[model samples]
Target: MELSTLKDAFDRASKKQKVSSSKVQEVIDQVGREIESAILKLQSVDSDQKSIFIDLRNKLVEISPMSQLEGSQKDLHIGLSKYARILEKHFNPDISKAYRNVDFDSHTVNQIIATHLYRHGLSDLGDFFMHESKEPSVIANAALKLQFLEMYKILDAMRSRNLEPALNWAATHRDQLLQNGSKLELKLQQLQFVEILQKQDKKQALAYVRGHLAPIASIHKVEIQKLMTCLLWAGRFDQSPYADELLSETHWDKIIEELTQQYCSLLGHSYESPLSVAVAAGFQGLPTLLKMASVVMAAKKQEWQEMKQLPMPLDLGREFQFHSSFVCPVLREQGNKENPPMLMPCGHVLSKQSILKLSKSSSRAFKCPYCPLESFVTQCRELHF
Candidate 1:
């Protein structure tokens, strides 16, 4: 594995490992080895990208404290910049003195410059020079470069349609935008971010549906067909909990019909038999059986009953022949008719019950005592004799 991937796997393992002395020591040793290997790989990266990452990391660490200074003088300057037109409008001379006393780092200077430019509608440094400013600007060239980089980041985010992060970055740099017209930048930001929340995160999606989708469905305004698609595909609802909803809800019927039709195409008329479709769909046991029953019941009652009343069909040549209605269920052959139940190789006589038992047996060793063909029982086929 690559050093980065190995480190990532170790980090994940560390997070999930049980709290214990052995586990802790094992993880510590693994991480120490990983870090040593990573350091060797780090030597091979281009110097400029490495320096950039290091500088960014240091800046993040330095600014970490500023986030905690709520209700302080620095907060007034920073927070007011989010809405106000000018730094002078929000900044107090006394607060400036206090800020100077605090030994502000390069990060703080960058932040101040970024904040000033952001509040004035000058998110993009390129556009800041277009509108001649009446107020004297004290922004350093380095700060402008930082602001330009930030604006570039927002632009990239806009192109990717990540509106939330772009909006967040825009809000932080609101002062820069108003003073300088970033018309093109703002236009780019206006592109709507499109996403289907259904597929984002399954747990979050389920929670959203339970909390939001269900209530909306109750009100009956939107077409939530895809939402039902997500639910059924996920198998989130069981027979009991979703029974009433599927029975009465118009949306669910469409989902069931579509799913059933697809299954029927794959499995043929046998699809109506719950066990057959369930097995074909890869659902085992009670849940599959329940879903199969639901599909049948949800189908048109007349059509389904007509299907059920039809006799057990036999494939004869190119056509399917349904046995006559007068045929006895307990008997495999119609008595006094040309057809009669016949035995196989060993010469024992029986009906469909015998064939069914052998075909459905889980054991491969199942041999028809009547026939020498051991384990050659074709499912529901008549004896050739």
Candidate 2:
């Protein structure tokens, strides 16, 4: 909503500028025409030279083009002042207000930055950064960098319609991909089959399907049937019923994303780099943090940086929420490793500390806080969030 208001303000300022420019141009043209008329009158005069000079001077004074020009310029200046104020009101250029001081290990910070750079295929920058930071360990351990480099190489090949590398990767990781409920191998072969069919090579397409796609046909019957039907529209798949689905560039993009996700999974990392996720979450929460900081300062309260958590909740989007969390209703505290949530046999949940206290640190029966059902401490299992 604030972005929309800023855009509207920008539009108004732009419109005002255009109007001011047109007004100034009109005033200049009118003044030019009056001066030209005065010059013509002076040129056509047949009277004595002194009389003609006096009449021309009087006409120039009557026209007063300088005053008109000044009025137009004043309007333009007023419009410019309003535009400046609008920009100042809508845009907050100083982000430092949202910043908080925290003690972070310089080495750890550098490692995270270097990893982010490498994860995004900026190995050159990553290497240079590690070199400058004097972090030999990061440079020496090239496993992570090599893994991402291979992923990038496969993605680069996919961009050029060369699926061989990706297909080979999928084939090598077929078992793991199937374990993760992935159809990447089948998808890659399907793309290959379509590519062959697109070239009017039905015989080779059939041969490729038999050797590569037929094995997965039993598992993905519908998908395989759709691909097989494409044989009738060989070299003219664009006019086929499946054109919208099979011929879209979106398929290539989706396949690339899938491959990257699987590759990252195999590497024991999230699809997005941890550093990138943290930065994105921080960027989204900055405005709220800044507003809170202002209020805290106005109230003469203690520094927010000293607090473990914010006074209010930050309304981050669903994408930022990566996992489920549990807060014990009995103690009104969040679950942690030391005081983890426990699920009672009766279906009620409470913190370990709460259960221990209720059961007097023994395996005795106690009434559930949330329900009338009773259960023994031993019957409660620790729940992981």
Candidate 3:
């Protein structure tokens, strides 16, 4: 609601500003025209110079261009002042009150920044940062730079409609890609076949189908059949029914994403750079942390930076969730090394401490907290996140 109000205020201020500027420009143009006319009259008038000057001065006074400009400027200033007040009311500029001083390993932070740079195809900047930081030995993922450089080279070729490099890489990693349930090789070949068909070269397209696509034709019958059908349209494939599916630029984007995923998988890495994910997660969580720091921690006179666990749970989106976590229903506590989650034989989970308390130190059986089934503490197994 606040954001909507702020936006409305901004729009009003912008519209007023534009109107004022237009009014000022109109006044200036009118004044300029009057001055130009007076100049022309003065050049032509040889006998009535004093009379001409009096008439020009009267014309300027009648228009009152300075008054008009001042009115417009005043309106603009009032609108801006109101907008500034609204901004001040809506936003808190001093965020330092929410800050907490925590000790972090400088080397680890530098490595993360350097890795992020390299992952984004900024090897030169990464190298410069490392050299300047005097952490040349901290380039632990230097090999990743070369791998990402090669990936960028292939992506660059793909942007120019050249598929050779990508095709070669896909073919070389065929077995590994297949093992990962990736059909990138077939997709690349299908694109190549389409490119051939687009040239109206039925013979070459058929030959490509026979040599490059025939082996994979058995499992991908439907896709291969679609490609075969495109041969009928030849050069006019853009007008064909399959044109929307095969010729869409989104196909290239999807293929590029798939190739990147497979490449990262082969390199034993996640498709998203870890540093990027961490930053995104942090950005999403910062607001909640700030609120907590200002309201809860400040009231309690506690330092959140010195605590290992947060006072409250942060509700992040699914994309930031990489693993499962368990909170014991009995004790209402999260699983940890000292109090790990224990799965009961009744298919209910509880923290180890909860189980111990319920079963009287494994000496007696107790009913499950979630179910009526009885279970011994010895039957409960520890669960790892």
Per-residue lDDT tens digits for candidate 3, residues 50-121, read 887798789889999889988888998999999999986555466575566878998888887887788789
Global Cα lDDT for candidate 3: 0.85
Inter-residue clash pairs, candidate 2? none
RMSD of each: 34.3, 3.9, 3.9
Cα lDDT computed for each candidate against the true fold = 0.41, 0.82, 0.85
Can you give the TM-score per candidate against the true fold? Answer: 0.16, 0.81, 0.81
Candidate 3: Cα lDDT at 335? 81
Instruction: Give the runs in model 3 whose Cα sits over 4 Å from its true position.
Output: 43-47, 88-91, 137-140, 214-221, 295-301, 304-313, 335-385
Q: lDDT, candidate 1, residue 86?
A: 33
> Candidates ranked by lDDT, best first?
3, 2, 1
The number of clashing residue pairs in each candidate reads 20, 0, 0
lDDT of each residue in 1-385, candidate 2, tens digit only = 2778667767776776787678768766766776676667667747365765676677667767678667766776776687677666545567787788888999889988998898899999998998999987643449889988999999999999999999999988988999999999888888888888989998999888888876677888888877888889987888999887767999878988999999999888889989988989998888777777777645767676677777878988989977656788878888888999898998888899999899885667888877888888888898876
Give the Å shift of residue 81 in candidate 3: 3.4
